[model samples]
Target: MTDKVTINIPVQYEAIAFKTKALGFDMPSDLQTGSLLKTLVASKPGGRILELGTGTGLATSWILSGMDNHASLVSVDNNELLINVAKEQLKDNRIEFICGDGYEWIAAYKGASFDLIFADAMPGKYDLFEETFALLKTGGIYFIDDMLPQPNWPEGHAQRVEAFITMLEKRTDLVLTPLNWSTGIIIVTKTSNKI
Candidate 1:
């Protein structure tokens, strides 16, 4: 027999995963990504966390699991149906769910900066790159996944991903590490207020 190691799954994960599948939602954060999100979140006690895509709250559950009681999370998604699944499954006083265009939300947001940002959607990651980055507190982590090629990617997406990596590489205000693991992750920490 072979030994196996399993990451701790959040309480709401199974239910959310079941519902996500029932609803035919194909894009949910994998376990590897979720584990990393949880670890990153635990680093910031009472931190303010932002999640740009609440896909069935799969990642949300993980983020919440790592958060202390005083920590708060704001999750946004444009799809009402998908986000509603998240809202229904994950009930925590620390979480605030917003159903609207992520790009619009980022543009209009005028609140305290976040300690960690998980940009799972296109708005904060591919669009409004500079604007969204400004919301991150210095030393705060900016995490993104799905960086490697995937089956769901559309035509020309690879080039776009390459371009995005190049752009991130040129930034001088932040330090970034591109991990080849877990759907390809890029963990960036803002080192200055230069934006």
Candidate 2:
């Protein structure tokens, strides 16, 4: 059995504190929120995965741990310092770490597709929703991790994010399920036949 996982506030916070102390890369998600990175990986075995953020490689480790040995992951982040840390922490051959702006990477990967896309980059920085949509294979999973909820959610902020969710829902090609977990997760599975 996979060893049980424990959540320690002190260690988790300390990890962020240590990384921030050594490298200035900002981290958007805390250890408490989001589906267990490990859980997602196990559920989507043998799936090609893409993660937009690799902060301190914490979640990176979780994803790698649960993924099938043959499945590959392309994890991206603009922070060289954080990426470097990830390199050492995540040494598995199945994972590729890239350092660059998420926008640039997403643009380049527009036509390419994957079985799963995990976005923990930032809260409202989800401006690339359309571009992201273009990169998912049919029956693929597009998961958005609410790194943080916009303060103006009530004042139309939620509307903007919700708009993206609404747009995806309108597409008969995809089955959408808004997962009501920590923070929030919008899980979209492509059901459309169109490429």
Candidate 3:
């Protein structure tokens, strides 16, 4: 008899997994979540990607594996300890690891819109949905993860997902699909700039 489970992970991502575990940072994206990010990134060749709350860069590695050579990624995290681990692990020219308040950085950014944005931080912490939406090019994908109830989540955390859903539903500029996979993900695409 054999008990087996198989999943293919890129070498960079594998390294991030080990490093994150060694650092006791359990917030790294699971394999399924990472794979999903890779798939999405692959869809947009030369995409400009933004990742908030870069926890150990497991997902960043996956995204880089799929992104085109011309694509660029900016991953931000407030924790110096965690971001430094990611920066050292992923020493690629295509990626810029920013150690600072993600919200503040995004708020001050006055550059071209992104092709993809992955919001890995807790959903409710982001109060700049309009700004984020504006920063995403029309038809660009915005991913928000960890929306489902988790074993470690405090009581009432699920309500945050609900409120987020409600907010998305009210917005006419974006289309939303709430998927019940890998901690639940809300996939939002900017369909228009209009309110």
Candidate 4:
């Protein structure tokens, strides 16, 4: 069997990838991760999705591809230049791109809770972990990548990854499964509002 992932890729993916490369942004989500995000978004029809990192909108394209017409996405990133690349390529009424700090956005967002959240940035994934998780509705899906070691990982990042995994394992309000594929993903489902 072929090990490659075969799915209907987003039309804007190639352009976004090219812009990301041209801009020298090295942290875009991998193809495998994008595939998973697309699949996960498909599961939530008319869902309100949140993407914590809009790195050239690589993952955003995949998420948008999976969303139904009634669904909407709010993608955030701190870099204006990188986010602009995504805004230029993926033009859909369903998407709202925010060029701002993911951490601050999470803290200040008082809108409806999200059905699915893709935390590819440090805010939702590392910095304000619980606070961001709190934004997930009951039974909502929380997705994050980069759990595995990568060439770009800074020193002591492996230790941080281990610690994050340990913390997730101890959370009783949610159920999580760690996948070794696709840059090492961790998919979590919120079971309760309580921590």
Measured by lDDT, the strongest candidate is 1
TM-scores of the candidates in the order shown = 0.96, 0.74, 0.91, 0.97
Per-residue CA lDDT of model 1 for 1-195, tens digit only, reads 521216588988999999999999988999889989999999999999999999889999999999999999999999999999889988889999999999899999999999999999999999998999999999999999999999899999999999999999998999999999878999999999873
Give one digit per residue, the lDDT tens place, for model 4 in 39-102.
8999999999999989899999999999999999999999999989889998999999999988
Give the per-residue lDDT digits (tens) of candidate 3, residues 1-195.
Answer: 421214556777767788888899867787777888888999999889998888888888888888999999988889998888788888899998888887788789998889999988752135677777788899999988888777777787678668878878898888889888777888888898898
How would you encode candidate 2's per-residue C-alpha lDDT over 97-121 as one tens digit per residue?
A: 9888888888777345778888777
- The runs of at least 3 residues in candidate 3 whose Cα sits more than 4 Å from the true structure, single-residue gaps closed, are 1-8, 123-125
Per-candidate clashes, comma-separated: 0, 1, 0, 0
What would the TM-score be for candidate 3 when compared with the true structure? 0.91
Deviating ranges (above 4 Å) for candidate 4 = none
Off by over 4 Å in 2: 1-28, 31-35, 110-112, 122-125, 147-159, 193-195
Q: Is candidate 1 or candidate 4 better by lDDT?
A: 1
Considering every candidate listed, which one attains the maximal TM-score?
A: 4
Model 1 spans with C-alpha error above 4 angstroms: 1-5
| Alpha-carbon lDDT, every model | 0.93, 0.67, 0.82, 0.91
